[model samples]
Target: MSDLKTEADSLNRAGIKLSYAADPLNHPLADFKSASHDLSAFGVLGSLLKATGEVREGMTELADVVTALHDEWQAEGKAMLDVGKVLDQVDRLLQESLARKHG
Candidate 1:
């Protein structure tokens, strides 16, 4: 149980760190999208611009996936903690019942 709680705490901490790391990626992705649009105004760089757009789209998808994963980790960590609490409560109740019966 303690180990479960410890792992949950670690997972929550990791999720928080992932949130922080993923947030910075949004700014750069947005910047790249904006830059891609700006480059679209030139006809000579059309092919290059298309490639850049594709790369930006992939990056955006990657960021979305990372964000979703972080959310899942946070939720799972909380769920684990809740389960641990429930298990601890049941354990205490059993101990008390046994003590009362044997007293």
Candidate 2:
């Protein structure tokens, strides 16, 4: 698979573990809305990595996801910035991680 897809897979797996550890049953947002929602295979892996502290290693994965999603939006020559709400979630997750890490 492409690097983005690989990273996405990793993030989905890790995110699930993190959610479970954080008490998904109580935290409504972090937990995927659907039981079959395979978050580890999620497209916004980079943001999820940052949100889950995986960014400390490096930002390659996050950048890849962002770029791929960005490309997807522009593939049809639409030049759009947002696609499938991935960018929105990535922004929020990254900001939250920054606050928790440095602030």
Candidate 3:
């Protein structure tokens, strides 16, 4: 259905935005390395080491959210397929019933 397609497209765009937000968290180790470099150069890591554990936990939580969203999207697609199959079967059955009555 066009409405479903539209909603799917909107959800896809939202997912993309969420993905971008999560990308920075994906490379925390690399960022930590950079912060270490900064600390050596400027004697300040900007609370980087102090927040490492919290940052890791937050990243994990965000990743879990994204995974959950993906799983829901997959289930929705399957549901749509099932609906279409049911509709097709109903159409076929209706046609058969009509023919039997007329004959």
Candidate 4:
């Protein structure tokens, strides 16, 4: 059991490190989304730890809720970025077509 717990902790730490590896290109909200999802496992581990009295530390129930919100907001932000890019391309194309027609 101790070995299992140790491995779990190592994996959790690894996940956190991996999340930040893309810091150059990733949005802050993307990191928030990744962190929320990664740390969510604590929601389950929190109960188990309390039941076993392994440690008095654990995540709050609100963590999961916040994570859910982050996920939704990240998706929305990505969609908006995509829409903005497409709109810019379309506007450029229209301008080019009008210029060609008149000139």
Candidate 5:
């Protein structure tokens, strides 16, 4: 139905936007990792550096999860679109067959 198609379109668009948003996180994550490494060279901030490392690890994990979710949503959207197309075709065929029988 049109509702299914609409939902599929919405998911696809949202996935695209999510991809764009996740992309910016990569740059910042890289920068944070680099900064964390740079902070490690200083001896006085040992405890702070450890905390930074942990935070960086957590950020990396979060980014990975977000990227994975984006991929899943995109795949789901494509699958939904495919299902909608198949259903539409079947409906059309049924309608045609009925018309032929009635005519």
Candidate 6:
């Protein structure tokens, strides 16, 4: 059980890292509105996934968001620096959620 938990946690972190890396604007979006929308969607899907600890669903949602944003980035022809913040948020949120579960 311990090993399983460890593996799952590692996978979750990796998924978050990959998803963050895939974000179209690796930087802050100059037009913050679109970025806010992206982050909101991420937060909601993340909450859903965390509530159930459904790793697959979480990964899928993260992947979809990144893909969509990647497309959007290409369309807009811009780079971003906000990827680290987003990934950090995910890591913090996921860890906090797990902590809540254990407590």
Q: Could you estimate the TM-score for every candidate?
A: 0.60, 0.23, 0.53, 0.43, 0.60, 0.26
lDDT of 2 at 33: 30
Provide C-alpha RMSD values for all models, in order.
Answer: 4.9, 24.4, 7.9, 18.9, 4.4, 21.4
Off by over 4 Å in 5: 1-44
lDDT of 5 by residue, 4-56 (tens): 45655665565456445555566776676466455444446766766776766
Q: What order do candidates take by TM-score, descending?
A: 5, 1, 3, 4, 6, 2
Clashing pairs in 3: none
The total of clashing pairs for model 2 equals 3
Which lDDT tens digits does candidate 6 get at residues 12-97? Answer: 55545554554555444334423433433435665564544444455556656866876664443322224334445666777788
lDDT of each: 0.62, 0.44, 0.56, 0.51, 0.62, 0.51
State the displacement of the C-alpha of residue 82, model 5, in Å, after optimal TM-score superposition: 0.8
Clash count for candidate 1 is 0
lDDT of candidate 3 vs native?
0.56
* Backbone atom clashes (below 3 Å) for every candidate: 0, 3, 0, 0, 0, 6
Best by TM-score: 5
Q: What is the alpha-carbon lDDT for the whole of candidate 5?
A: 0.62
**Model 3 C-alpha lDDT per residue in residues 26-100, reported as the tens digit of each score:** 476445544543434322576665565565566566656765765665566555555555555666676778889
Sort by lDDT, best first: 5, 1, 3, 6, 4, 2
Model 4: per-residue Cα lDDT over 1-103, one tens digit each? 3343454455445545444444443465455545544544445755654443322122333444555665665555555555545555666676788889999
lDDT score at residue 37, model 1, on the 0-100 scale = 48
Q: Cα deviation of 28 in candidate 2 (Å)?
A: 21
Residue 46 of model 2 has an lDDT of 64
Task: Give the per-residue lDDT digits (tens) of candidate 2, residues 1-103.
Answer: 2343445555555544443442323344323233224435434666565444443233445444544554553343221222323544665677788789998
Pairs in clash, predicted candidate 1: none
Ranking 1 against 4 by TM-score, winner? 1
Error of 5 at 2 (Å): 10
